[model samples]
Target chain A: MDEEWIKTTDKKIINLIRLTRKNTLDYINKDINVSTKTTRKDLVTNVDKSNEQFLVNNIREIDPKSKILGEEGFGDNVNSMSGHVWIIDPIDGTMNFVKEKNHFAIMLALYIDGKGILGYILDVMQNKLYHGIFGKVYENDKEIFSPKNISLNNGLMGMSAPLLINDYDNMQSIAHKSSGVRIYGSAGIQFISVIKGELIGYISHLKPWDIAAGKVMCDSLGITVTTIDGNALDMVSSETVLIATKIAHKEILDLVK
Target chain B: MDEEWIKTTDKKIINLIRLTRKNTLDYINKDINVSTKTTRKDLVTNVDKSNEQFLVNNIREIDPKSKILGEEGFGDNVNSMSGHVWIIDPIDGTMNFVKEKNHFAIMLALYIDGKGILGYILDVMQNKLYHGIFGKVYENDKEIFSPKNISLNNGLMGMSAPLLINDYDNMQSIAHKSSGVRIYGSAGIQFISVIKGELIGYISHLKPWDIAAGKVMCDSLGITVTTIDGNALDMVSSETVLIATKIAHKEILDLVK
Candidate 1:
């Protein structure tokens, strides 16, 4: 997606994501079909399937030339990021959606030749839509200023709960060194916090759909999103990723290493 | 206060809290004066003082006969929860209010002769008001049903950061036994999660205003709010409190002990 094309599709992509949220909310009002995938912690709901299908079908119609990768396997068998590729997490934080019925999100992102172009995340419960077009990010209709580049000691952090609890890679020390730690139980919600500058950073192992939208948005601001050992993120892997402000990012990378 | 009088004050108290939130939002738009109270974490902002003053004055006029204990020193210095007493935490999570401008709450509760009567907690940014009258809890006028009594292994738990990080009182084992762990950085927000059955329990040290509203609400919902040792909560002291569903409550008490 070129700059002009990215700008042009913002309204359409946003509208489609908004409609997706409406449909997801409607499904929650009725009984849901939930199943355990790889593990009990790894769950997929009927809502996730239908939402992914809806997004994939619409994206294929809107951009006939693009390839798509979706969490629920509703899209193409994507291998590489060539030409135009869209990533979809029909419902990020499905656990929260199933357990809490709140704090869940709808996420979508567009990439061109492995570079992020446009990304959208809607915190459906809060009714807040956050999106990035190239280098400018907006909360709803208001463009957000980049958060200050603060160090770990000066800011809060969000960490994977199990990792933080079990002291994985010195995560316990990381949590204590920061001003505070938060675990909202949603990758999308935690990404929103980092993008909005509420949390200086978050560390989690994320699949492609989970990392794509945030990576695109963070690239616009001066934030860092990389593998735990500070490598470029693979476009199609479930890798341990660290998303943080520039300064805190460096501090954490060195500490964990 | 009689049950009838308590019923009459519902609309008035709710309206006052709503107005206080309006004022609090307005203040956030302008510059704020922040001062360290006891510790950096235990901060008190200009908004805290003013909101407490506003609530204290209004309660005096509305009830006139009740004694008030407020977080910001705007009300009486009472040692006991005797007779009609009202407690106020004008801004619960002041750090969050000052730093994130979200996830904070405005809290007020009424106690008659050392028994909980009415309690109100407003999640300001979410614009969600949850209250309890006598033994019935309401989340914005809609009555809430009792959450299932679940054990530690069957549900998520919220642990205080320092305790969990340092493994205080075997917090690490407790966190591991539960399905998951969360740390949201706000007492009021965590309390809401437990009352709504989102979490099976949460443990933290809380002051009077911090515990009052949640305690009253939990009393109505069969949730447990007590000292870590399972003793009755002391409303005046900053006690280490554990609030949970009944079964999870006992399970945590045993694990921590």
Candidate 2:
């Protein structure tokens, strides 16, 4: 696709995603009853299902041919990403949303033929969006330069629950080498750290929706996002994703391997 | 001490701590020249040292006989809690403060003859304060009941860098049994989680100032604050401190031992 066409489509999608996110935040913020959908562990609070359904319905209307993969099970069982694919995490940090009532985000990513085209990470409380299209990344429309490459020994890192304990793929070694480790229980916030260069990397075992948008945003900023073993991630599958600066990436990969 | 006397002293000390914290925050927020005081591994930013001095000066003016032990070496080299000993962590999460400008806290605890008389943990950005005197806990002047006693299997746990990596005293086994583990790099914030019932407990290798205030606050709320081996803590020494609810305390001790 041409640059101009990409820009136009990107602008439209960015505005749409922002609107959808704001609506979702507003809906949840309003007084409402909450209930468990399937099991106590699996919650489907009014906001969760509503947000996913809203995104799916709007995406279907806007691009009838695209396949949607959504966390709330509102979309199809997308087995392949052969054509246009839109991955949505309506509420990426449900526990944080339900408990802390904050630190959650709405993540959306668009991919065409396995290449990330656009990404959006909406930080609800701060009302700042870390977004990107093609080669450019932005924080509320202001262009942000990629942070200087920092090594594990000099910067903090973010690791998820299971990874921090099990030493899954030698994560224990990586955690020890980094200056510190932070776990905020939100993929969107973790991605924001990578973009802000506050953290050297974030490693988590995540679903497609949890990382799709973040992957696109990181890729645009010259950051590396890959599997724990330094392999390209299959966007449609759950994997141990490591998003980091170039130097941190090398150190983590070495330590983990 | 009588209950009424404890309550009154708690209120007075809490107010004083809040005022001192606000003054320190304002001073640091202003642009000032800073130089490294120690190895890059152990930074003593201008704000850290100056904040301690500010607290020391104010404490001496208010209570000339009180002994203050502060993080930045501006206060007395406290070896005993013989009188009205005040333990202060001018900036609990200095790295976070210097880097992200958030997540750090000013912690103060007043012990009268080796007994905790008052404690304050201030969340600067949110402007919320968790404080306690005797057996009553308060969040910003409102009474706060002890959070539901959650078990290790049902709640999150917090671990510091060394504990999480080296599995100090078999922390790995205890962490594996919990729902998840979170590391936020701030002693005050981690203590806030326990007091708020967000985490089952937090374990960290810390100094007297780093944990003195948290120890008092947690103990007042009926939470266990002790060394990992279930020994009483020496207020003047650095050790692996474990703060948790009753059930989590029992479970973690069993697992780690």
Q: Largest lDDT belongs to which candidate?
A: 1
Best by DockQ: 1
Runs of candidate 1 with Cα error greater than 4 angstroms are: A1-8
Best by the TM-score measure: 1
True contacts kept of 2: 0.45
What is the C-alpha lDDT profile of model 1 across A1-257, one tens digit per residue? Answer: 35566666877898899899889989997998889899666779999999999999999888999999999998999999988999999989887887778888899998889999888889998899989885989999999878899999878888888788778877877887787888888889999999998889999878999989888889998889999899998788888889999999999988998
Pairs of residues at least 3 apart in sequence or in different chains that clash in candidate 2: none
lDDT of 2 by residue, A1-257 (tens): 56786677677777776777777667765764456655443445677778788888888876688899999889889888888899998877776666556678888888888888888888876778888886788999899888879888878889886677777888877877777788988889899988887787899988899898888878878899999889999888888888999988988888877
Q: Candidate 2: where is the Cα deviation over 4 Å? A: A1-47, A95-102, A124-128, A133-144, B1-41, B133-143
Q: What is the lDDT for A24 in model 2?
A: 69
- Report the C-alpha lDDT of model 1 over B1-257, residue by residue, as the tens digit: 46687778988999999999999999997987888887666678899999999999999999888899999998998899878899999999887887688889999998888898889999999898999986888889799889889988877888778878878778888888887788888889999998898888888878899899989989989998899889997687888898989898888888878
DockQ (C-alpha based) per candidate is 0.64, 0.39
Which ten contiguous residues of candidate 1 chain B have the minimum total lDDT? B1-10
Error of 2 at B109 (Å): 1.6
Root-mean-square deviation of every model: 2.1, 4.0
